[model samples]
Target: MDKYDVVVIGGGPGGYVAAIRAAQLGGKVCVIEKGHLGGTCLNRGCIPSKAIITSMKLLSLIKSSSSFGIDVQGYQINFPKVISRKDEVVLKLRQGIGGLFKAKKIDLKNGDYSNRFRAA
Candidate 1:
């Protein structure tokens, strides 16, 4: 059986940050994520939402650029491309977090360990 000084149940920002801090303090940490790392923030809510917001902000700025002496031509939003970009952003951030876990030597498990979990 694997042993861990700190076992984080969720992979959300709080949980992952806690695990990393514990590891930095010289503890063996494990993160059990039933879903993707970063939970709703990185997957659905925060990061992905922010990604779309950024795109929208850029579009808004471009639309208002004519008032700032910047001429704009026929431009439209490629929604499919926008969605693709958001997906790419989310994927990159998730991979980056996974990389950090590996670098810190933290064990990341992708399953529900609710009943099987025990602090060791």
Candidate 2:
């Protein structure tokens, strides 16, 4: 059995950041993440949506270039490619964040803490 000075329930910005801070201060820390790291912000909610929004903005700019006297034509937005790229970006950032946590020596558990730990 292992002991930790702190155990964080979620891996969202708040939880992970707290875990890292505690680890940095020399407290043994463990982060239990029910889903992919970066929580909703990095995985499904914020980062993914932001990536899509940015792609849409870029597409709009390209389409509207002629209005600014810039001759751009025959450009088509490939929806599949856009989605794939967005997924790639999100994955990369997630991995980077996980790496940061690893560098800090924070143990990352791949399941929900509530299910794994029973409150005494």
Candidate 3:
């Protein structure tokens, strides 16, 4: 097994940040993530939800464009496209985190290590 000075159990904000910092400090760091990087906040949670909300908010604004003296007509909501955009946003953010990890020389492993480590 490869040795590491720091082994972060999750790739969420806390875990990835810690791993990156450890690497920056000249430590051999490894991040073990069971799912996609950036954790729930980036994947199924914050980022995804925010993307959808932002799209809906824009639609609302466009609907009320008449009040702003802006003429708008025949706007069709492409929900699949909206969802695809959200996925793109999430992918981009995740790739960013991956890039940072690479620059820091932090190793990323995919697997749940939660059961392997314990407080002693």
Candidate 4:
């Protein structure tokens, strides 16, 4: 019953950005996202995992740095710190997307956009 120039589903990196860009281009846009903004990449899959992996890599490099004449000892993985940093990163990005949506004056619909979306 309602009209929109563009409807974006998923609200992940691709969907959100597309919605914002469409609005910037002078289209009436609405985003339907099942969960939080930034989607799987920002929430669970890539971004968080990569943050942990990078921390792991740092630990690895530090452990094996003796070959380069760098001596280190008593180093361990601080799981809480890693988790905290990852959460921090995700939070910032999520807030950023929210800010973008607000600035662009796009309508945000919190729902599952996998196979269905309706505007009214």
Best by lDDT: 3
Better of 2 and 4 by TM-score: 2
Candidate 2: residue pairs that collide: none
Order the candidates by lDDT, highest first.
Answer: 3, 1, 4, 2
Clashing pairs counted in every model: 0, 0, 0, 0
lDDT score for residue 60 of model 4? 90
Off by over 4 Å in 1: 118-120
Scored by Cα lDDT, where does model 1 land? 0.91
Q: Alpha carbon lDDT of residue 19, candidate 2?
A: 93
The 10 consecutive residues of candidate 1 with the worst lDDT sum are 111-120
In Å, residue 79's CA in model 4 sits off its true spot by: 0.6
> How does residue 3 of candidate 1 score in lDDT?
79
> What would the per-residue lDDT of candidate 2 be over residues 1-120, giving only the tens digit for each residue?
678889988888999889989999999999888898788888888889999999999988998898999988788989999899989998899888789888999999887457567554
lDDT of 4 by residue, 19-112 (tens): 9999999999999887999988899999999999999999999989999999998898889999999999999999999999999988888976
Instruction: Select the stronger candidate by lDDT from 2 and 4.
Output: 4
Candidate 3 residue-wise lDDT, 1-120, digit = tens: 688888888999999999988998999999999999998999999999999999999999999999999989999899999999999999999999999999999999997676677554
Highest TM-score among the candidates is held by which one? 3
**Better structure of 1 and 4 per TM-score:** 1
- Indicate whether candidate 1 or candidate 4 has the larger lDDT: 1
